[model samples]
Target: MTDPAAHLLIVDDDERIRGLLQKFLIRNGFIVSAARDAAHARRLLEGLEFDLIVLDVMMPGEDGISLTKALREKLTTPIMLLTARGEASDRITGLEAGADDYLPKPFEPRELLLRINAILRRVPSVSETQSAPKMLHLGPIRYDLERGEMWHGQTPIRLTATESALMRIFSACPNEPVSRTQLVEDLGRDKGVGSSTSQERAVDVQITRLRRKIEADPKQPRYLQTVRGAGYMLAPD
Candidate 1:
């Protein structure tokens, strides 16, 4: 059974598919919203937030992969792509494009439910222990793990949703070098959503934005330093 509180966005050009998916997922206990295409999805996205998105690869105008790439620019919401193509190369393309996961068309509804649950399971749960004053000092910035808050001296630093998610992921395994692939998967973007170059670029952009808020010198980051080819590691003082 799906979580009734889990909100899902279904995007497909085919009305039949969209309606069927919405009804089926709703019956399984999810709150679902359907969009006819990428354009419609964008409109809905501007006004509402979803726990996950079910996107169709083949659409009239903007394809699922393209929209996935665009969304990865700002949002870290989990996205699963529905595609008719079953080729391995196509699957790779979808993952590289920034999709968290992909499902081929003509799939069993049960399988879809299972995939959704699996992804949701991977999302870390908030703990009461996180409310303690366990803090990490990063130069002039300080992060309070329990409160999920960051501060610079006496002032609180604001973080975007994506930035906060990244911080939580990093704090869960401090001093460890987290690979880009791991970060992408944890962020809930389709693992098959982007090229290596695209994933690297997106990670870079997020890192730069995060540094501006947490680092005294964003250009020469001391706390969030890169680890050669291994990936990024957060070295808190």
Candidate 2:
């Protein structure tokens, strides 16, 4: 179940579909907002923060993929693309653009609900009460386990939802290699959504993005290392 206060932004050019999704998601315990196109979505995004974004791929002005890529430059909000195109390449393109998930058009509301909940579940929850901070050090980077935040000295670093999830998984077992298949399962990418290979590749993309934040040089990562024939491992200092 998703947090009842979880806010969602629905961006679709079609009024009928946008209205229907807003009503459906609201009925399912989400606070929903609707946008007719990417421009409207950007306007809303500037003033308000949303737990997740449900974006349509075929918008008139700026398409979902372009908006997603742009938003990822500053925001860490999770985005789920709704695409009419079902090709694996299209889905991978969405993932490459930093979308957390993609649901092809003509999907059942229930499946969307499931996917939304899964992504929300992956997001780390902040406790109202404070506890001693558990820190993981990677070069100059510091990750707080309890708060699910990363820091460089006094400045905070932003992490997307999927990147946060991956950090949680790796931080739990530092210096241990985790297989691509296991990483897929931990990230909640179920079978039948896309081929296993594509899902692993998506994970690779996410890892590359994350390395940019944690490693001094992403191309030659020192903390997040790849183990030959095994998988990736986090060796924190």
Q: What is the TM-score of each candidate against the true structure?
A: 0.62, 0.93
Model 2 agreement with the true structure over 1-237: per-residue lDDT tens digits? 768899999999999999999999989889999999999999999999999999999988899999999999899999999999978889888988999888888899999999999899887665521343388888788999888899999999989899999998888788999999899999888633778988888889889989988998889889999999999999999
* Local distance difference test, each candidate: 0.78, 0.89
lDDT at residue 143 of model 2 (Cα atoms): 93
Model 1, range 1-237, lDDT digits (tens) per residue?
435689999999999989999999998899999999999999999999998999999998889999988997777687888989956566667666666667887888887888787666545345833543378888778887766678889998765445666787787777888988777766654443346656555566667778877877889888888889888888898
Off by over 4 Å in 1: 87-89, 128-170, 176-235
Q: State the weakest 10-residue window (summed lDDT) of model 1.
A: 124-133
